[model samples]
Target: MKPVLLFLVSTAWTLTGAQYYYQGLMDYLENRLLAIEDRMQFWHEQSHRYHTELKDFKKLTTEAMDALSKEHSLLFKDLEGASVRVDRVEREMDYVESQTSPRACANKADKVVEQGAWGLEESRGEEEEEKDWEEVQSKVSDCVEILSGIRSVKILKRVGSPKGMWTRDPRSSKVYVFNGTSGDSIYQFNSVRDFSSSLGVSSSREIRLPSEFSGTGSSVYNGYLYYIQQEDETDVQVVRFDLMTGMVTDIAMFPVESHALVYSLNPETVADLAADNEGLWLLYAASDNEPNIHLAKMDPDTLDIEQIWDTRCPRENAEAAFVVCGTVYVVYNTRLASRSRVQCLFDVNDMIVSEEAPLLYFPRRYGAHASLKYNPEEKQLYGWDDGYQIIYRLTMKRKLLV
Candidate 1:
């Protein structure tokens, strides 16, 4: 019985020890699983934060690229504008240089016999030329008057091109309108009242010219129309058309320097034809190299160049010019539009000195004038500014001679 009890005791001890060891092993495995779960949760949170930061960075970069593109486009436009301005300036400079060179002046002197029969030296003997000039100057001082200022402005019907001309004949009540710089059509009105009426050319007569005129320098005197026609590349033909017959009465071909325009500011006007109290005058530049304006006295009947005079008025910055009596008033302005002013003057009789000439400024109207036609009969200036037809009433005073 003692032996059997010993055996049972030993077996019980061994079973209890095996159960404790199994429990310890299970605890160790559960602790290890819990640690692994905590590590996985920490890693998941870190990955989510990194993704959000990357998305925000991508959005900021896109916005920056869009802003830079807009700036680049604006910069390109500004550069283009600057380039255009620079090109214009360069062209003007080249034109000026070609006109003022010594070679051009020499060529002009060799070709032209400036003093014709009408010149002071040829009109009288060389010995009496000084006396003749003084006498003519005295007569001019007595009869001719200086322009004081513009008294009134009447904006008549706004017609045709921004560069055109309209004038009433000094002898008759007839009004003539030459539309664009180059056209074969001319409109005529019976009277100034008819032109001013709002009928809008319904009462006007459209007379087609035989040939197309080249420039805006055209005029009507008595019953005839005188205009410049381009005859080939370097020559201009002055055509005289009879209003009554509607036929070309005479044509005179005159040589010009080049295709360069007479007025730098007004590129459309190659020459300026003006009628004053002294008769029909042709205002032109001798050559592209000559900066001064030249005046020629033309006989309305013969289409002959009677005399030529160097006006000494610069062609640079000149927009339009008109002759009052025997004096030429050159109106000047900037390329960028400004108040027009009579900056230069030339008198055939040498009655008025340029230094003492009145400072004449046109009332600031619509842009610069494309044409200024003086009517000695009404004592007014018919002007084309932009597209408006303006009439300037004059106030004259006895010229202050020096």
Candidate 2:
């Protein structure tokens, strides 16, 4: 019985020792887990703070970039303004110089206009001489023969402002002239015969164009007059005028930056507007460069620029333009005072000027500020002279290579 009691006491001591060791181990493990949790929480807080900072940093960088971009654009605009100012100053200087030292042709012409009977006779003699020379030249040259055959009969007197667009209705042979800047006067003819009759007695109508259409020139297609005008200070718009309905429609609006050539000046606005069977054409020069004519084909409906010709017109002072059978004929004035003009033909497909020598003349009676149109039906050319205030018709004496 003693041995049994001793063994029981020993076993009880061992169980108490094991319980104390297990309790101690559980407390240590809990302390370690708490420490690990605290470390993880610290790391997570650091990560979140870094993420916030990174986002703020990115936002700041973008804002900075945008601000810099804005500054750059403003600087560029200021520079462009400076360049334009310089150009204007240069042109003014040139004009002043020209006035001081007149050209020989201008001086001679001015002398005749200023002098009385002597001047008149001199001018008349010069004109007669030029006419005789032209006659002889026409007989000599094939191109001149065709150009010479063009008879410019005075059809109308004092149509409108010198700066205007002229076109004829193919269906009715009615002549229509649109003066965009000068009170929007649209001179419309009722019949071919009415063109010669006295203004009040003539069977014709004069109406104000739409208030918004501020065009320099225009083309007629499918019985609609299509023109490009200032949409706003910076935008140019293509619009259509329906003669039958007298309704004006906005076809498209493009920023002036699109062409960088549509001038704000009265004389050098859009040089000309023309249309053929294929599409509409816009004749513009890049930034007051009157000599370089840029021809572009525009979509009639969408007003999208479909194609820009690679050909650069090799002429200065191109006042009137017309497209026939894919050949663009431009009326260029070599001398503003004299009736000296050159008609240059540019082929759109070839992008080169035709080998045909320039028709060294236009209607002698018509003045510098004139608009040209080709009558496909009659196979003739018509011009409205602003200086002379007359409408003239031209027909080729021989078949043109075009």
Candidate 3:
């Protein structure tokens, strides 16, 4: 009986131990499952945030593209308006060319002769005859002469920028050299002889200007420096600066089409300031579409416009131009730099006929002229070609006018 009771006790103890082991394994699995569910819930929230950010970025990109499209539309409209203006200018130019034909000029000359004969019969006084003689002499002095040819070319010195201007004042012995298209300083030499030699910067006097110049179109006259000042992108102002006082004496705003360059070859020249026997002149293209150059007579002292003339000289291949007396001689060259020639001219005094105009060609030189400044007293053209300062001596003859 004792042996059977011991066996029953052993069997019950083994069963109790197996049941406790199974309960512990079940509790561990429940805790692991809870941790996994928490991780999945966090991942879902992060995915929602990423989706919202992507949508915001897409909205911003669309807004930027819309703004860019609007700007492009406005730019296209401006281009179209400019095109229309160009077409209108072309039509007006055609009409003017028809009127200035050779036949029309001949008819106008016949009427002028009849008027002159009628006036001769009515006039009878000595004073009137003296006045008539003086008038004839005055007219002859004002560009009744045309350029026969270029007599000689003297290369003074090679200095400064490859494209710059160096000239002597017609009224004085002072030589002024500008290094670039725009600058506030000017190199002044006492005489032409001094400029020809390599004196360096120490010997030359530097004149500091109050305002900066915009283009290569600057000239010295009667101890004053005249230059173009770009007030804005479109508006232009001519400033007359006194060399002695180093002050801006005068500023005159002139109408110029800055959209197109004055000289296509030398774009740095917005408006060329030229001096001749008749006084100061401004050469520029007024209309954006009109490639023809326009000439304006300006008062040296007051910077006032005396008169304006459309030279009808094409600006396509023109490099530089100079005024002799009252006639404009436009020098032209190829884009690759060839022998420059005076292909077109305009006489403000109406003394030169198209048929009688001389086609003067220049001797082959370094390159195109950056600027051609005429010295009335010396009767020479001070030109800046490539980097060489050159002087062109001109031979003149009486113009055969209608």
Candidate 4:
């Protein structure tokens, strides 16, 4: 019994010591947790501060974009008004020039029609005058002089419908004509030969289409049409209409207030699409609020889209008026009065043939986008001048027939 009593004393001492030790450990742990909490609070404050700064920067960017967009809109309106006034001036010029030119160049058949046959003859006495006029049209160095008159007419019309409206793919064909108003009309055209023909052109059955959002542009691809629909007062939605499937899907939405970015949105994945045989290329640029350029290659078969390139112009003054072969030509105006720039020879590898160096340049945009087009089949290019849209044969005169 005495031995057991001694054991109890030792056990009691050990337990008492252990209790104090545990209390000390608990206090240490509590203090450590408090310190950790304080550090976390500091980090949270810093994080909130950075987030605030980021938001401010984004707000500034948005404001800048908004101001630019509004300013550009006003500028376009003024330009349009000026363009109308120029039309009157052109009328006066026409009245003056009409008094002369009793005989001029021949027609498409190389036979004289309006000008008469005798006027087409090469006169030795007037050879120098004819030679000079022809030289201005043919020589590369003379493009500016030839295009000078054209620039005056175009600077005013740049605000209206594209003077250089062109289709990229050659597969387009004339479908049935429909009578409808622009904004109130919903029009659908089919590219299919058989399906479209099945719907008789003179039929009484009427299909009504709705007006798509206007401010955003539209594109036509193989078997599909894509455009942006204004979702609300604050957002825009990208929608695609598949001709084969007869399905409409909203692929992406850009909220004007919450988010502002520029990227490509297509119905199907086109990552594997190579630029060589693909059909229908669509290029769009938005400069004012969102300074972005999108280059998309669309597949004719599956209504698929492949976005190959994206570029940013924060200042929002550049416009890619036209694309030929694999090159993109941009016309830009700086903030400085009457100073403009042409960004040419742009090559985006994914947009066209890979490993190719595309040489392109701004021809002359007296005050607006330059109008130039290239025809691969004919190996020719066309440029619009004041009163004439002139054709240029890119291939040498010797090998043109090929």
Candidate 5:
């Protein structure tokens, strides 16, 4: 009976130990499964975040590439423009070099001193002739006589509607007549000589402007047309027109006060534009004040006005103006039957008018509506009369203002 009791107690203890071991195994298994599930969820969230970041990076890359393309195109265009300017400068320098060559036999030795060796009789005759010429010049205060007269008259047949300022290109000698109403209405001489001869020989080419483009004062530089455009009477801006591409660009804007103060009364006013060796010039003529007219010289590239001067115009209205050899010549209506209109020269250095008046004056046919233009290449002045259909080629007779 003692042996039986001991065996039974031992079996009971062993069974209890086995039950605790099984319980601990089950708890370990459950904890490991929960940890594996949490890890899988963390991996899924990380993948989604990486995908979102990749999408944002791709979008930003595309935008940056687009900006770079635009920058490259602009840089290329600028380089091309620089090349064109350099070529033009080279051509100008070559022309100057060619023109500066000295002429042969231009300077002559004094014949009076060498006459004894050659022959005294021949020298005496030449001296008497020179004295006679000198006497005539002295009587006139050494006034240099310039032959002034109309060289030719031609009717500009191709001009559809000539209403505003006219100018001649210094390089090409092509005449451009502006029509403010339409760009298609702009007239250009196919051959200036043919058009000047009234032959109607060669047809003109039309420069079509955009519908929104409008201007009054016009000039050409390096094959580009420049003009002042007035949006309103008080709003003015400078525009550049490309002759080859028919592209119009706004370069600069004038002060509102400049427009408002000028041409206070006249609603339909004209602006004068002229160019010479000295650069570009602009004339603001119509004003109610004492010194009504204002003249300005503009920098070609910057559009900055370098000089400004005031003039009390002697005539009723200023039609055309040009700067040449450091002098400003103005054409205006004189309103006299004997002399309907006149061209007056003003010394730019001395902006002073002599009491004698009209430093150099010449009469013109009274065209009720006429315009004047000067061609530095031809050294000729062109006068166009819309009323009589007459365009006059005039040569100036100039004398020093005594």
Candidate 6:
């Protein structure tokens, strides 16, 4: 009985120790759970504060945007008001200027009358030029009639300038060619008022040119003189003369079709023509063809069939086009209206295209078969209008600057 009671007491002691250990572990776990809940509550408070601040920030940003929009609207209104005031001031100034000036319109009218008187003088000049043309035409007609038998007079390039009026030989290279009559008689520009003094024509032996080879068309380059030659044959052809050897060489044989006359100041198209310095260039067309730009280049000396270059001619640009100082000046006309379409400046070397500038005004109606010349010495461009036979000496100006 005593040994059994001792064994029961030992078992009771072991069960009490296990119960104590389990109770301590449960108390520790409950404390840890409370600490975790406290940390979670703190985080929730912080998160709520951040969300409220974010909402307030968004509201402020929207308000600021609204204010900025209003400010922009006000600025735009101010600018509009300023522009209106400026326009009003300009109008008032213009009115005052007109009132104070010697009526510019009246002055312009007087100038037109004065110009009318000048036109009378020009009319007389034209009369004289007409006589000269008759003589030229007679000679040209003679040549053409003779040339028709040779190759059929198909193409013609008329080369002449106002300077021809003062030439000593009317039948000289640029205007006339005849049978080498007498040396002095053959060189016939002496018909002009100042022929004797100009050529110093003394005797028939002084042969400046052969009588058989004088015409109104002349080209000089590379230390040689070139003139148009039509032999006594039925074909009217153009030929080049060697001033050194006194020999004639044939050049172009134009197409044998009836086409409108086209003229060009581009040395390239003329083949014999040349632009000595950087200056204005011109291209003239006389026929009624769908306008487009055309370009050509040739060696002035050899004239070895000049190759074509790039051109600014629009699809409807006039049938003729030319360049000056590397800038392209074109006459664009289709039916009746024509305007000067000068293109941007281009480099002759690199062929680089740059900014473009329109001249004077919107393109204006102009005469076809017009002649343009630039005197670098005068910095002026001279044009001859064949329609009414007028001369226009134009200088570059800041146009339409009202």
Model 2: CA > 4 A from native: 1-155, 200-203, 255-268, 288-291, 387-402
What 10-residue stretch in candidate 1 is worst by lDDT?
103-112
Quantify all predictions' global Cα lDDT against the true fold.
Answer: 0.78, 0.57, 0.78, 0.39, 0.53, 0.36
Taking the tens digit of each residue's C-alpha lDDT, what string does model 1 give over 149-169? Answer: 676779987877888888888
Which candidate do you rate higher for TM-score, 2 or 3? 3
What would the per-residue lDDT of candidate 5 be over residues 1-402, giving only the tens digit for each residue? Answer: 899999999999999999999989999999999999899989889988999998999899989999999999999999999979966765564355333321111002221121122222344578775764454344332212232344555555444344444556777756666643224356677456645654431366767765333434467766677776666656566666777788875476754333323332222444556666566777664444434556777776677878776644533455445555445655554343223333444545442233223323333333534445556566665544442334455444443322
TM-score list, all predictions: 0.66, 0.53, 0.66, 0.34, 0.51, 0.33
After TM-score superposition, what is the CA distance of residue 67 in candidate 3 from its true location, in Å? 64
Tell me model 4's lDDT, rounded to 2 decimals: 0.39
Cα error, candidate 1, residue 143 (Å): 4.4
- Candidate 6 stretches with Cα past 4 Å from truth are 1-238, 241-274, 278-291, 315-321, 337-347, 350-355, 360-366, 375-382, 387-402
lDDT of 6 by residue, 121-156 (tens): 234467775664444333221111000001111111
Task: Specify the poorest-scoring 10-residue window by lDDT in model 3.
Answer: 103-112
lDDT of 4 at 182: 21
lDDT tens digits, residues 1-402, model 2? 999999999999999999999999999999999999999999999999999999999999999999999999999999999979976875565345333321111112221121212222244577775764444334222221123223435545565566565667665667776653434557777654566564532346775567544545666776777766664556666777787888886567643343344322235454356765455777665454444567778876666788776345644555566775455766666454435344555555432234434343543454565466665555555565663335445443322211
lDDT of 6 at 291: 39
Lowest lDDT sum, 10 consecutive residues, model 4, at 142-151
Candidate 4 residue-wise lDDT at 278: 26
* Candidate structures ordered by TM-score, highest first: 1, 3, 2, 5, 4, 6
Structure candidate 2, residue pairs in collision: 150-395
Clashes of each: 1, 1, 0, 3, 0, 24
Estimate candidate 4's RMSD in Å.
21.3
What are the per-residue Cα lDDT tens digits for candidate 3 across 1-402?
A: 899999999888888888888888888898889899899888888888998998998899999899989999999999899878866764454345333322111122211131222122234477775665455445444344456666677988888788888889887899999988888898999898988775554679999987788778998888899998886788888999989988899999988866667888988778999988788999998876877989999999999998898998888989999898788889999999977877787777665544455456666689888998989888898998888889989776554322
